[model samples]
Structures are given as structure tokens and as C-alpha cells.
Target: MYEFCPHCGLKYEVEPGYFYGAMFVSYAISGGVALVLGFILFYLAGDPGGWVYVAVIAPAMVLIAPVNFRFSRVLWLHYVAGIKYQPEL
Candidate 1:
């Protein structure tokens, strides 16, 4: 969660509440993770009980929280905000 990028001196937040969109991105990422994990567990685990999904998906989301947060922000910045990489800058 840098206020600015050290390598390029680029400010991370373009405006107030800029990152609010990132929350939705994070939600989408999380939902996708849960669905994928649930599907995998459903098939590989031989269609275990409902509690099994709750048990596995809960911890898996927690474990991937940090990665999901950063990834969502990066996705928001690169896709929604139209921030382009300036390799020369």
C-alpha cells in the first residue's frame, strides 16, 4: 500500500476515493476464487457435504487476501483507470 511508487515517483492514488472501485474488484476476485475453489473441491473431493465448501473456501480466501487486494488494485489501475505503463519514465 504505497502512497507512491518509489521507482517512478508516480502517485498511487489519483484522487480521493479512487480506490473505492478497487473494493469491487477485490470482491469480484474473491468471488471468482471461491467459485473456482468450490468447483474444484466439489469434483475432486467427491461432492462432500456443504460444510466442506464452507470450511475450505473460508480459509482459502483468507490466505489469498493480500494477493487479491494488490491484484484487484493493479487490475483497477491498469484496466478501469486506464493507467499506462511508462517504461521510460
Candidate 2:
């Protein structure tokens, strides 16, 4: 990731290791996706076999990992680090 926001020139990391907390945010995002997908598999798909669940969920998770990783870090910056949005910037 860039050390600063290209548009506004704001520093990306407040301090060293700041993004370590984003790991928890990423975990939460993964858990939420798993829970929702599990429900869909259980109810809509009529309780597919364990292997089916693994096959479908694993790929979906992998597909969303990039988005989830970026979002999680942004979330950590906005909420945990109290970085406020400044549209004027």
C-alpha cells in the first residue's frame, strides 16, 4: 500500500504496526460472510454436504479477500483510529 493517500497526501499509517488491528476487522468480515453463506447453504440449498460447503465457501472467500482486506483496513482507520472523512480534501 502507498504510504500516503495520493489525492490528499494524508499519511496512510498513523504509526508503525497500525494495520495489525485490521487483522481482527478482516476476521470479522470473514465470519460475517461465512455466517450468511452458511445460512444460504443450509436453507436455500437444502443443507448441502460438508464438502459442498467447503468448496463454495472457500472460493467465495478467496474472491472477496482483496476487497475485504482493503475495506477492513479502512474500517480500522475510520472507526478504530478515529480518522474522519473530509470530503473537501
Worst 10 residues of 2 by lDDT: 80-89
Where does model 2 exceed 4 Å of error?
none
Cα lDDT of model 2 by residue, 3-52, tens digit: 99888888989899999999999999998998899999999999999999
Per-residue lDDT tens digits of candidate 1, residues 10-36?
898999999999999999999999999
| lDDT, residue 11, model 1 | 91
Error of 2 at 37 (Å): 0.4
Q: How many residue pairs clash in each candidate?
A: 0, 0
CA-only RMSD, every prediction? 1.1, 1.1
